[model samples]
Target: MVSSDESLPQRLPPIDRALDRYPYCIVWTPIPVLTWIFPFIGHMGICMSNGVIRDFAGPYLVTEDNMAFGRPTRYLRLNPKNVDGGSSAWDEGVSKASVLYGTRMHNIFCDNCHSHVATALCNMHYENRTSWNMIILCFWMFVCGKYVNVCGFVKSWLPFLIFISIVVLMAVYF
Candidate 1:
């Protein structure tokens, strides 16, 4: 038989172990200001201003580091067969790479586009460049874990983008 650890799925978190364990609470990501989902400014706090974790049950939010919150991703439930307790170093790395690649790809070509500027968001979901490498290791709720605003509150930041751009363009032209 394969060792439990070896059998583990490389990229997916052990939701079974999570559910088998403790009571989860909500906390904000350290760079909360960078993420619209997080209401509190920094560090995991008593309340998650708009944390995605604040909305769930089984996928309880567990505070890991001074700056991280943990929860399994919806990918586990949505695609259970893929959940194997195997080596995830490869998979996790790829996902991170995919995110970075997607962000870079999106930004390089679209940053100047109105929709992109209108959103007025940082390049990607992540911030705090220094802590980036450790972000995957940090036990934290997946952005799509318990909550998925899909731009619920963040969308509000859009209208102003158009307003600001128009003013800037006027200044440049006239």
Candidate 2:
């Protein structure tokens, strides 16, 4: 006779189990309803264990939500091991940093959501501030308005459009 336990099917582990290796991660998501105007300008948040995400959703508000951006398109690890202190100490430092900026004003050019995550990561003093620079570059690109369309030609391709316009004017006049 077959044993009862052998008749049962094996249960699979949770899909998020793979994420355990990354205790902290940067989550990215497309801008809702404004993807056309800002295709590359997406939202960013810090992902904690068990799918919790901390993000500066708006002015004076930092929220922790589950799967905050409806499943992040990417996960950028902050390299906790690189912190001057141990992992636990680093975690505490990040937590304290988050609390400090939790009620900060959100600004596009200055203190935005990306800044929130970057500040938290930087609190560990890991000596890698690339993420902060990346955020600033992304913000600048968004403000400059990069695109490939007629309406955005001036804002997106200002230098090229100006040069072409000048050439056309010279040809028409002389």
Regions of model 2 farther than 4 Å from truth: 1-22, 49-51, 66-69, 128-174
Indicate the TM-score of model 2. Answer: 0.56
* Native RMSD of candidate 2 (Å): 11.6
Clashing residue pairs in candidate 2, if any? none
State the lDDT of candidate 2 residue by residue for 62-133, as single tens digits: 777633344454445444446666466556655765687666777866777677777766666655443554
Give the least accurate 10-residue stretch of model 2, judged by summed lDDT: 12-21
In angstroms, the error of model 2 at 143 is 19
Cα misplacement distance, residue 131 of candidate 2 (Å): 8.7
Candidate 1 per-residue C-alpha lDDT over 1-174 given as tens digits, one digit per residue, 9 for 90 to 100 = 899976986443333323322112222232323333333222222111111221111122222222232332121122223223212322232233323333432221222111221121112222212232223322333443332133523332344455567778999999
- Number of clashes in every candidate structure? 16, 0
* RMSD to true structure for each model, in Å: 14.8, 11.6
